[model samples]
Target: MTRSPATPLPPPGERRRLREAGALTRDQLAERVGVRPATVRAWESGRSTPRGRSGEAYARLLAGLAGAEGGTGEDGARASAPEHSEHSGHSGHPGHHDRRDRQKAGAMAMAMAMVTVRPDRRGGGTAGPEPSAFVQTPPPSALPSDAPDAAADLTPAQAFDALYSFCAPALVRQAYLLTGRRDLARQSVERAFQLAWDRWPEVARDPDPAGWVRAAAYEWALSPWHRFLRRHRQPEPPPPDEDDRALLDVLLHLPPPYRRTLVLYDGVGLGLPETAAETEATTRAAAGRLLHARETVAARLPDLSDPRELHQRLAELASTGRLRSAAPPAVRGGSERRARFWTRAAIAFTVALIGATTLTLRTAPTRYEPPVPPGETVQGVPPPVAPGPLSEEERELRARLRAEFPGGPERLTPQAR
Candidate 1:
């Protein structure tokens, strides 16, 4: 209990996403948020959290970005990148405002994540081909050509819709990959959104609102408890394509942590650190999981020995289903109802507990009173003495009495009168 509850914020990964979604250079964002660029870097890298006034400013900034990005949900997923790749240009070495995030993961991750070794048939490692293309993380759009220009100006409902429209579609696909069940995936996204709706202010102001919901959805989708549910005990139908089925099977074969890391990094295109943050893992741990996952997949389906192939296959597999999201109104309403019900239940429980305590207090003895001994049969009273051999004198007296009064002693009953 000594450990305080963790402050709710977008994990380090989300800080980077918010930065990218806004299409602002870290420096520009820092300038506006009133912090140094290095601090911003630190925030994004999971090195530190924003603290005090500066943190508030940063939160406000992120809130603005989240709001803005949520507005452009429809046209958002067209993640654009420069066509020709120079290692240096892709290095994302600072100095550009309007450029969409060069890489959601940053240059170092791009370098470290590019090529993973392939395991040969003998289980030894060899160099393998890299992923074909780096799929950028999708930014939930907050602006559109036809809609209002500023996201901050929008109403709460509108903002929630924007956030949902931006995240729900892709989130469903991602959830399907995690759960390997379309229904579960849909439920997970809906459930996550409902929770988000309940905590709308926190989520709306978060640096990466999408990432917040995403983490929740992933957690729910991958929960071990789901296996106990009758509906989820049996597996759902597989993807239609033969390749997709095999890929999904391979994915499902891995442990949940490894699978989540792979999907977040390879499938979702999160950078190494970002993936680690989102998965609540250390960078090294995330790397190990990712590496192991890739090895396992490659070993099982040699065609995907390259991480790139796995990434592409993951996207394809996730995209194959009809994992649609429920409407914003329904989700929001459900959230409100659930919140109210739980609140009432908690209040009732508290009232009942207090009443029981009050009754016990009232009836309980005020002073310490020793327990009374249990009643036992009285002792020391002699048992009825049967006739015993009479003493000489008593026997003589009895004889005399018997001689004097030949009749035995008479007993009389009371007359009715």
Candidate 2:
């Protein structure tokens, strides 16, 4: 019998993550490594895998950037999990099959974890009150409806699908909390996923693809376009639940980074280290943001004495029962949208600048008057009035002090005698 062809290996996700972690854009990295930008993009996208001399050089560059000894094992082997194929395994090699199976099992477990969305069982099927109708998408239950049973010997697309199906709902809910606008929040989440889909090769290899997407969604939800858009919108009544409405109101008042740090840490339950990674902040900086967020939240909700309880309550308030799991909408006319955004932003900025200039001109202190020549006064300006005669006691005291201290006269009389 003829042997089946081997499955193509998936691109290592670390290549992209490390490049990002190292703060090198694709073009920058390509320039540094003496390669075409397209080559680097290909390597990152897994369209063309790097190996041998090129792979080693690529790994070394990334490792150096990441401050690691090597991006691969000691022997310079790829660190990514080995790709296994059910149809291509040898029947005679039982030991090899067993090892491959074990690896597949571990990979599958990770894949499942990436997508699993377990609801709080303690609520006893009492799902939290529904959010505003526009905000409610679809909720993931014990298992996402689209999740594959196992990730055994899966392709990159399969892996990405599994991840997207599982995490999109939670991500949308998180975006909604950040933006407080249903349409904007949904758009943010969709845009994030769209980017992820386009870079699935890199995303597939990520340790926490969902976390990556969540961070992106946070940025998108908080974009400045929302501020400009708000000017044209009529305000709507707040959500019905007093606790939730109050929590959201407080969240909206927070600085964007502080709010993002809070959502990622307390609301999403991300560890400090991962939170820092996702936020592109130093661990110290991320901690400080989290601290400020908590203090602000506590100050706003004084009845909640315990910070942990406040965190819990905020997390609950952020939770939703539904999210849309469909594929992200296609991104079309991106340049046009960006142009419109910049145009609006510039107009608003110019208007504000003009208004500020007008106010400053109207409210500025009266024009700085030029000093008068010794014998001349300014036009339409009054001269200093002559002083009244000193009282008897003042003259006597000055004379006495001048007699007692000869230098005192010089100090007292600004003009020399």
Candidate 3:
């Protein structure tokens, strides 16, 4: 018995043709296409038609199968037919098919480029650039306003879990960038998440929960204790071997306010207004701080002429953890000891002054009598009375008499009588 010739599959027909011809099983096709078996069934049953690149892929798959079986090329045989061939007219010409394939490939390339061009989410430890460097253009379909409240009425643990899942790594990175200390970064991020957990309802209601957490991390980084600790602790500089040492040295010279402003603006690519919002300063003040910071850094690192180049360098340094190891010590041990001694001396002087003030206040005179004129009498003496009720005229005369002799009736009485 001779084997029958395999059925000639129609060009760009339903995926069922492959199933019937045994070119590919449903599972095999689904696996190759990276889709579920249910999707394969959908294509084969003609519930919906594949379009664009998907359709092209299907057509290519069919053409390869036909070529393998020693059949005429799907398009070659069709091309020799009448110009208005009924089968090929409505669908599209071979040239059109090739164009579509090219378009599909172009789109895929663009998508892959976008993915590859994106910044590294996990710092330079893995690969790629910093995530902040990417221009995040959110899709219109990604409107958070329409998203279900994933964080609504959640318990503290649940809220924290969600926050950690969404924000912890980003927060850690921001903290590390701001503080340039891994331990501090971890502390800052953890504290920020704790605070968010404490106020989840309010945080969940915010327009941007991630932004809120980021702001919190910044605040934690700027706290007085953190500042004090940074001042007192002599953190080792970033490796002197790194190329970014010059930049790090310049940044270390910047005053805290200026450094923070510059980092938020240049390192984070935030606008002046946004930096102001983040730093809790006025826009003009933020701009001035940033300007001063850049000026200081530029003066220190003249090699970094361009502000953008400096920013990129700093970002890379931060990503690589080389920036922290490159920082110059803020102050020497001798100077720190002198500062502590002066601080103690000032405290002692303040205590002495307070004691002296208290003693002076307690031992001062208690009497507060007012001085009297030479002729004035004390309250002890009884006042003299008029002999009788006087008319208005008599009252006026008595007043004049009193004015003339302040001793009053005593002076008017007969002498010694």
Candidate 4:
């Protein structure tokens, strides 16, 4: 059996007239049509057309309204009929479907473009571009508030998940190449994502969100401080393949800056300028580092002379290891947990400081106190005199008197004696 023809919709003007004639609000019609009120407005204004199930339902509703309005609906349709017929003549017409496709394509292109070619973010005497890729330029919707209306309907969490899903796995591998430590690589990606989640609105609005995350991850992986971490100090088991192991060892041996430049340019395929900007070095310095790194690698491994071979080998090395990133939800949860911990810590510290200040203010001396002066030695003070043998003439008499009194004292107390 032949398939039935799809339901037909009235002309845009007729669609609105029929709806008005039936006394239905845009909201009411949108609800019946299973779309947003904005969608209904778009339909009536001819900015967008309904399609598939929604379109068929919309057509059925219009047909019913046209039938109900009877003669008035008929006259209005006759008036707008030519335009609608012409508009629909080319199925999925440019003014109709092709227009939508172009719109969708345009939005995609814009998003992609936004992800690349960010302006230099470094501050200087002259104004220019930057990256984190490197800066953001927010509507408040959890993610980038100023993003296209296409993403307007999505919740912040959904948008975050989309970004996380797209960027996380690849980021893990890149982090591994930068640090030469699988666990550290995983940590770097997770921490970066955690940070991204914490500052989601800022990250979402960034010109190149993936690049922003990449920079964060790479920074963590290549940090000088990681050398101090207990887990990172010990060299982990090497790659299984001899070549892979040798390549990884060479990568690890390179100075962090050179390693990063090589990875960014050859492995991740970033431009020299981008690598330099990300590394916070001049373009020349970046070029020199990259050259030095390539030379070092070629010196160690003669077979991998070509840059292409090196790049391919690097990719293979990263792939050989089983590096994995945490789920987006877990990362988001961890980030929130960390944020809350720090928030509590800050609040506690603030409260404690305030209490100390208040206590000090209350108990502190209101006025300056004068301290007692210290005593100093006085000049020419008289010394104490000793009785010198009670004068020699008196000494004999005093001794005789004492001898008599000694015995007389006992005799004087006659009752006790």
Candidate 5:
């Protein structure tokens, strides 16, 4: 009889996890690994095993799934009961539980520190209440339906989804323009959303959530981490697909300010006023930036008929994952392992500039100096006034006054008097 073709086997990792969880049946494992049931039986019997990339990928997926289901012994698995209690203290001593709680609290504090939002540049125009006050306010158990205001009804999750859907794409596009790298764009956008999630209620209530997200993205893009990456690391360009190449060329060639302005106006669809508000510029200045941006793009890509087409193309590139192939500029290794060195450098630079400017202003001479008279003395004594060269009428009046009163001549005092 002719021999049947050999069957593929399940990934080692997956098979191991499944066995540990008591969930593995030969037939089921075989189906999962794309092999015949007999092949799975042979492998479980130690007669054969799967190998290579496909096996590895299958193993990783199975292990991840098993971990999610609380299985033990998988690489990604939750700890066994004893290990869990030892570390997490779900069933251990009270001190262990307290320590775990404190550890969790510290981790949360550190995460919050990573993406701290600076004070709004516009002062208190739209940032809502201070953080301390907001923290004290209790969150409602459930969001009220039929609430008249959109802001009042929005939950953190809903707000995040809204901003993600509305703002993330625009931010990603802007980041692409700035860095000419899709991964950086996506990361920048995601980081911005992560930040938005932290301040969801406040951001949700703001008049322009999109603008707020864009500003957050810009802040992240210009952050010290980003700057360091740009300076010390070089990002590899995306694969040379036609759409990818075209988009990259268009963005990379744009002057930095024009690229920023265009992305804010065209990609994000912010009006001049809103863009100006987010960028902390005047409306007229924003308009000028947009006008210049359009002109620049039009000049470079004259073959393109519509400005809207560029945005559409970017959207397409993003959706197809063409843009995500580029790697982020690496800043993972070096002196500041946990904190990015560039961020520290930027903070130092800003502080130094402020100090220098303050010192200069303090020491500089006043612009408006008082005028000094030619011969007048302003020291200790009062200045002498010279006698007037009188007109004929004034002399005649003086003579008449002297004749009218004998004391008039004495009244007309000497020049030095």
Candidate 6:
């Protein structure tokens, strides 16, 4: 027995045409099929192709419309003989299938490109190149308007875990690009998130909590401590591809600020002002660094001069090195960790201060007091002076006298005075 050939899912344009022909609004169709409007939009825009139940449902709808219009039915059965024969040549055309496949691939590429073109933080149109396919770029969706107040209800540990889960991978990827070492990059992200965990109350309440984490991650990745540590470790071999190795080598050789600017601007898709804020530089400085970085890369790789090509190449570089999400360092309660860190520091400081004070008191100079004989009423007295210059014979005589009689000097010392 032979299985029948599966029905082909309609192309995005065909699906749109069917919807228009049936006079069904996008939302209506989406609701009928139990999917979000966005999913329907994605189908129409060729950003996604439906599958399984959704695919069957779409095929059924199109077939029903085609049957009513006196054309092909669900099983590709033609209602009119002449029309079927006329379109028969088009149906078996292999070239036509290839063209459709290319269109679908192009659509998919365009969709993937839009994922990086985020809406402006200030609620503006999508920033970056004009997307080949249209996507509704909504405002940066926060944790809802009520999320800020609700976030406070969560314990610091819970808040931190949430932030870490949401933000760590992207942070790690950004860090990885900034520092050419994966271990250092991961350490940097973990350090930054740990810092965020410590300050969750402030971060959770901020307008853009993700921004805070990104800034911290970028700074930690580019810090001197990492650089110093990196010097002692054996350098890893270059990346696999020549282009990747050359680009990364050039990036590593750039000034730290420039490298960060490039990562933020190109790698992270941040605007100049935002990149500047993250890098702790003025907008003009960030722009200059970005321009310089691009020029440097272009000078080395001439193919990257085109803005579209440069953006695409940089995006590819960033994506190729993306780190798989790893289990984060165990999160202690943010409040507890912070309290413990500071508490330990304070205790150490206090112990050091007390020890210092005690040591100082013990070693300090004191007044010199002459010993008094027991039961003797001693008066303060001046010491007696000997003659200005004694002859060697006299010194020998005085020494001999002192040796013979212990009290001789006291008895004879006043005679010279």
* lDDT score for residue 87 of model 3: 34
Q: Write the per-residue lDDT of candidate 2 for residues 134-231, one digit (tens) a residue.
A: 12223333222222423455655555555665566667777767767666666787778777776777877787677677777888888877667764
Cα lDDT for residue 81, model 3? 61
lDDT of 6 by residue, 1-417 (tens): 433225566678777778766756555677777776557757876887776676677667777865665543543353345555655564465355454343333333322322344445455676653221111222232112223333334445555555565556666666766778777777777777777766767876776777787778777777886545645276865665566677788888888899888876766667777788778889998889889988998898776676554544454454456465555446344336767989999999999999999999999778887788579666888788876988899999888886875644445444554
Cα shift from native, residue 88, model 4 (Å): 16
* Descending-TM-score candidate ranking: 4, 1, 6, 2, 3, 5
Q: Per-prediction TM-score, please?
A: 0.58, 0.45, 0.41, 0.59, 0.38, 0.52
- TM match of model 6 to true structure: 0.52
Badly placed stretches (over 4 Å) of model 2 are 1-110, 115-155, 230-237, 320-417
Q: Give the per-residue Cα lDDT of candidate 5 at 189.
A: 66
Ranking by lDDT: 4, 1, 6, 2, 3, 5
Q: Is candidate 3 or candidate 4 better by lDDT?
A: 4
Report the lDDT tens digits of candidate 3 across residue range 84-176: 354346334434434433433333322222221223323533343224322222332222221222223234444334345434554565565
Cα RMSDs, all models: 21.7, 27.4, 25.3, 21.0, 20.0, 18.2
Give the Å shift of residue 412 in candidate 4.
43
Model 4: per-residue Cα lDDT over 174-206, one tens digit each: 788777788998899899989998888998888
Top lDDT model: 4
**lDDT for residue 96 in candidate 5, whole number 0-100:** 33
Cα misplacement distance, residue 290 of candidate 6 (Å): 1.5
User: lDDT of each structure?
Assistant: 0.70, 0.62, 0.56, 0.72, 0.52, 0.63
Separately for all candidates shown, the number of backbone clashes (residues 3 or more apart, or on different chains) is 8, 4, 5, 8, 0, 0
lDDT, candidate 3, at 219: 81
